[model samples]
Target chain A: MDFAAIIGNLDLYLQGLWVTVQLVALALVIGLALAVPLALAASARRVWVNFLPHAFIYCFRGTPLLVQIYLIYYGLGQFAAVRESFLWPVLSEAYWCALISFALNTAAYTGEIIRGAMAQTPAGEIEAARACGMSPAMTYRRVILPSAFRRALPAYGNEVIFMLHGSALAGIITIVDLFGAARIVNSRHFVPFESYITAGFFYLCMTFLIVWAFKFIERHWHAHLKPLRG
Target chain B: MHKLIITAFTAVLLAGGAAQAKEWTKIRIGVEGAYPPFSSMTEDGELQGFDIDIAHALCAQINAECTLVPQDWDGIIPALLARKYDAIIASMSITEERKKKVNFTNKYYQTPARFARRKGSGIEVSAADLKGRKVGVQRATIHDGFLTEVFGDEVEVVRYGSQDEAYLDAVSGRLDLLMADSVALMDGFLNTEQGGDWEFVGPPYTDVKYFGEGAGIAVRKRDNDLREQLNAAIDAIRANGVYRQINEKYFDFDIYGN
Candidate 1:
């Protein structure tokens, strides 16, 4: 194996790294926005209120993200009416198609995390808020959401890492994310194992950063829960 | 228990007979939908161009109903091997390295590989000029392998998943030059408004090392019969002028095996 060939295109590799960061950052923001409402509705006790998002979360989670990207980019593109529709402008670009798929996928997984955290929010705390004459909306806002968010942070961090890796699929759809850049290098060089390994190392670095961030958050959250003896 | 065992044996035998008698009424032919003028989808979502037309002619010749399966180029070879499709009619070049894993028919269409660069880009127009400059080609292609082997590590190589993507990037000033077949580069960048933006810069290059003689129908190596059938059909099409008619529809000149 020629080490120089692997190390030669550092600029291209860095550009790919930058694109990957952009994709993950954009998708994560949109994913969190969608996840919040879906998770709240899913945690609702009313059957009709919770059913739709539950089904959505299940379907998105069940299918592979690769298939989801294809269905969104190529499968939906097969329809002439869809091509002619007003939404065609957004759908025409491969970047948006990948973003939509990653956003929806992350939202499904994150929604479940948030919903489980909400369910674990103490009932006594909610009852105490109600006893204090707080309105239902106020009680949930002040008591439920904050607690659920704190509880959900660790799991949400893992989802963030997964989303970063998943955005690599954007490479296949012609998006020049970090992985896409690496693919370009590999294609040009015919050195798949090397290019992909370098790309994987970038992902591993990002994964470590994510873990560190979550660890810091966990420590900050538990500061008030320390034992009196300690 | 004896009666049940006899009934099970009879059922297994009947199922095996049904499996053996199943005829291939419908066949799937994988095409790279991104290679325009060869096998590309239109803005209106229809699969059009040369490969689509040629596949129809071949299917009629073989007396088999065929469906054009749109597969990504990188995955096309593996997908064919995995039996995701019965054959590949994509603009797949028949190379010796590829021949070890997959079989190919006689050359259906041959377009010499050319270097494409922006109108005034100082990037080299020749293989010797390519030293130290960045060039892009589609991955897993004979062109990519050719450049790597011939140019060595001196030239920077960029890979694109599809030809269109590479062209867009090259036009956007991301790549110094992009290389692909003359027929595709003609229909892709040269035939459009961007035709002025990019032009073929180098002499057409062809050899076993670079272009692999020409493009052909690709099937699994074990499927030698399918390879023979496709080669025969291609020969028939060429003899009757059907191949030239289809070639001239997309290209200004004939691209059928020079």
Candidate 2:
């Protein structure tokens, strides 16, 4: 079973796991932050306000993340202006390129999820908030956003896991995330099963933890919506 | 029910056709169309490279209709084993580790590995000198193995999916140095516009322990007859000056190593 190889490369696996976590966590936070505004703009009454955001959502969601990453990492580098620009320092690093691609890609999907949840918000609750003398901003902030977030939690959880898997593509761009480490081991030792199986185990562990955490959050956040027992 | 019976009969006939005995009449050859000077795609999607020419020459010698299948380098071996292609004519080095999984023809060519750094970087290519420096290499290559084995503790090895990626990183200054086949570096990168600022920094390394014998066409283990045929073709091309003709087209020096 080549237990020795797994044990020997444990540090590399952990380092890769650390990179994967950093990529997913940072991207998720940035994506959600960007998504909130995008969702609001997408749901606005003014056609002009929603147009660009809708286009952005469609472009990002429609294209493959791998192409987006390659464009940012290699495509941008092709331009003399990009190379000479102040942004070159960040753009030159594969780590930053991967993070930016992940953030942009996830923002589109999360924006749609939040927009859908906002659309599904009951008209009665919004009316009740307005009836209680709440301002438009207060009604959206206190009632609509909270309700939408709770509803979006389950779907958002899936996006989180999807992003975790998507982060594997970071390896292609030269960032040694979990999949990269496995690839290194596989190439070096020629033990594909042992090398990849160990990485898979780590991914499975991460997935389980994510699922458990989301379940815990869902239980508390959606307590009011839970069915009653006799 | 009548239509289902007809469909079943057609399926059986197709299966019977596929199970027929192998004639070396038609052979599918896999090539990584990304590696330039050896194998690369033109702007109009034509595969043009020294390796492609060599594959054609070999196919002609054996009187077979050859088909070139472009595949990503990482999955090239597995694709061969799965019968996605009958053989790999990519610039795949003949190594002991690879020999365990697939059989390789006699080497078509060999070249030493070399390291390159920016013209004014002043970074010496050595294990001690490269401490903590980021060195770029194409993943799943002999150079990657050599770098990791020798300088792994002293330097950070950044593995890219393709040689071009490593070249890009090196030119962008993200990588302190890049290691790859000497001829490939010269033809594909160092002689190009973006790579104009880079130059080889160390003596060419050709230790057989890591670099292996040379680049060879790889076929599945069960394809011994095909392997023998390819080896004979390689010898025929080399003897008849055809190998030198292709070599002169791509490289000035003899790429066939001692």
Candidate 3:
């Protein structure tokens, strides 16, 4: 019942929360940007166009994100060439290494989610776009992408929460995210329950907010499917 | 500080060992099979190393049939308190902070902390020189606290889950410098081919406030009888040359800090 640990280490937790927010927010945004093109290529008819994206998704989704983070953070620096390369500056920092791995890992998962949504795009809707003189690029940009994004929204929300949880791994690489803060507290005070319970509570609060926000977005997006009000 | 008091009281409940004097036999020892040259798992799950040999020797000296229980480093203490094992021989330090929760036998071995870096890196241990440098240390260890207390934010502290992970970062150039037990660094990294270009930097840090009195066998706080038996066995072995035999099996030098 020594919940006072949370109050005493409040500043440390806040600093950790700030880092977690930055890492997850930046990773999700970058992942969303990469996923769009990845899904498009993955869904293409030509094997050459789809091959690279398919492989990228499989490699990432197939392996654990923790291993991917380890490889990027600790693996990349082992190479003499990597150290000599211009990218060394970014690769040398744990923050950047964590960010890069998280971005890439999320992109693979998000790409598959969007690709599944796109595959279900009605043939009639696509035909209507084509009949209206919409070019293929224009059709994807204006209709296909928009429709797929709305359909993928719920799944993407889940991915966002998963990313939030996954960012805890940043602590292993030395980035003091929320989990890291709790770990520090636990190690220092030897109060594993109090420290971790505080962290779990924070995460629970965040997950709830994300769910509520997503529910609002779904309501607005599914307005057309709702019963008409007199 | 308040949490420290709370931890002190709760430690009583966690390690609630029966205060009765019991005959010592068939004891289970907690060992972390992850630290190399001390205790590590072979490809086939057989455990071997200095700590393993020492544990065996101690058991023989005390005439106790012992079983080695493999445990992760992070949870070793909690596991000990939970009565999962009667004692820990995992190269755990005898420190004031740890004294709050567990009792320790006399130190079986001692080593000082040292920093290592690129051969020509020219990194000094001073706060001014270490400013902005990334120093890697195993998280939740004595070295981590020492580094933070010494330099505060002057150095960018990178704490890894294990000492091995820190060495990997040291090899990858992600860390400008590294810190750990001198013996551990020699065994875990300096002896490896990847460590060819790395050299020990800075003087050995032996502040009792941080490094403590060195590695000791830990038992539940109320297990006074077992602690006495372990201490006598340690003394007996050290006098009978059994300690040296085990020490030389792994190290060419005195590992007991004699």
Candidate 4:
């Protein structure tokens, strides 16, 4: 580890850190928005409706994100029609392509977590809502969702961290994220181990912060379960 | 309804499987996509520039089915040895370090190495000037080996994964000087801001002692017949002006220095 090289390239490294944070933040927000409805649809009684989201979740989760990124970015570009389409503008940049892939991947995992939590929602509480003449939509919105969010917090936290780490793949496609900057530095400096290690240290710090935040959220959600001393 | 849907889905799956098995028969040609003007993917998702066109032409000339497999530059040789591809057409320089591991066809394209510093930075280095400066060169390359031999330990050599990144950092002011093939450096300078700011310093240095004998298509060591076939095709192309046509299209002039 050349401490001097790390110190010398500190500004570039910091810029890379900010890009990574942006990638994760944007991906998580979009992923969560897509996941909740998919989770609800997957648990639906209709076979056709549930099958659509189930297959979506399975396909995204099964393949490596690297392959997905390439397919979306390079493979899609091969079609001239795609280049002429409305999506061409949005898909033209590496950042948006990576963002779309990461968001879709996180949605799949987060959906599964949410589905599992929904399945565990106490049937008796739903039954009580029905007796009170509450509409199905009201019952889910006022009761079921809050409980499922609490139940899904820990697993969802893991998904958040995975999405954050997976954002590193953006570097391969030329997005100037932390790993991308490290790769550039390593190429210039010829110290792969040192450059990558510095990037990893920053990622570790970010991961630790994420973990700390999620733990606090978990504690807050579980506070109701704590027994009061008589 | 469910039964019909299941039956239709099954038929579609079978048809898709059969189609994939028959379409675009596999012929793997390895490439280092990190090298632009060769096979790098642009930010907008195009696997284009030069080597791609050349590979397509070669496949058509040989009447062989093919696919271009993108591999990292460092592992390209090892991957070929492991039977990962039928041939390597990356902008790989034919060097002694690589020749020990793989055989080369006759030179496909050749460009000499040149030095660059930020334009007007007044940082000029003659062959004698690199005695004790930190120099950046792409790793596992003839250029890096040449610098090591010429400057000895007086030069601090840094190896990069690709020429593009090396030039990028040099442009960003991370390195004092960068060394790469004239063609690659030219591509960088023409396509990038860093290239605009960095001027090529000194005359290009060539020959095996410097830039090696030029770039060639790398085949397995044991594939003597394939090598002969490739060499013959390259010779035919050169004689018929096909090589010149392709070369002229992408480069400003013929880079296969005499």
Identify the superior model by DockQ, candidate 3 or candidate 4.
3
Off by over 4 Å in 4: B1-71, B74-258
Candidate 3 per-residue C-alpha lDDT over A89-186 given as tens digits, one digit per residue, 9 for 90 to 100: 99988899999999999999999999999998999999999999999999999889889989999999999999999999998778889999998877
Residues B37-90 of candidate 1: C-alpha lDDT, one tens digit per residue: 888898898898899999999988878899888998876776787789988998
Score every model by TM-score.
0.62, 0.88, 0.91, 0.56
Runs off by more than 4 Å, candidate 2: A1-10, A46-52, A189-198, B1-23
Q: Regarding lDDT, does 1 or 2 come out ahead?
A: 2
Off by over 4 Å in 1: A1-152, A166-223, A226-230, B1-25, B126-132
Worst 10 residues of 2 chain A by lDDT: A184-193
Name the top DockQ candidate. 3
Give interface RMSD (Å), model 2: 2.1
In candidate 2, how many Å is residue B175 off? Answer: 2.3
Better of 2 and 4 by lDDT: 2
TM-score of chain A of each: 0.94, 0.96, 0.97, 0.97
Q: List candidate 3 segments past 4 Å from native.
A: B1-20, B43-45
The Cα local distance difference test for each model comes to 0.82, 0.90, 0.89, 0.79
Model 1 chain B weakest lDDT span, ten residues long: B17-26
List the candidate numbers ranked by TM-score, top first: 3, 2, 1, 4
Model 2 lDDT tens row, B1-258: 999999999999978766543547789999988888898999999999999999999999999999999987777787787799999999999999899889999898999999988898899976678999888888889998899888889988898878877887776667888889988899899999989999999899989999899999999887787898899999998999998999898888888877
| lDDT (Cα, 0-100) at B24 in candidate 1 | 45
- What would the per-residue lDDT of candidate 1 be over residues A1-230, giving only the tens digit for each residue? 54465688888789888888877888899989999999989988899999999999999999999999989876777676887788877886677889899999999999999999989988899999999999989988999988898989888998999899888999886677888877766545545567888899999999999899888988888677667674
Ranking by lDDT: 2, 3, 1, 4
Candidate whose TM-score is highest: 3
Error of 2 at A152 (Å): 1.6
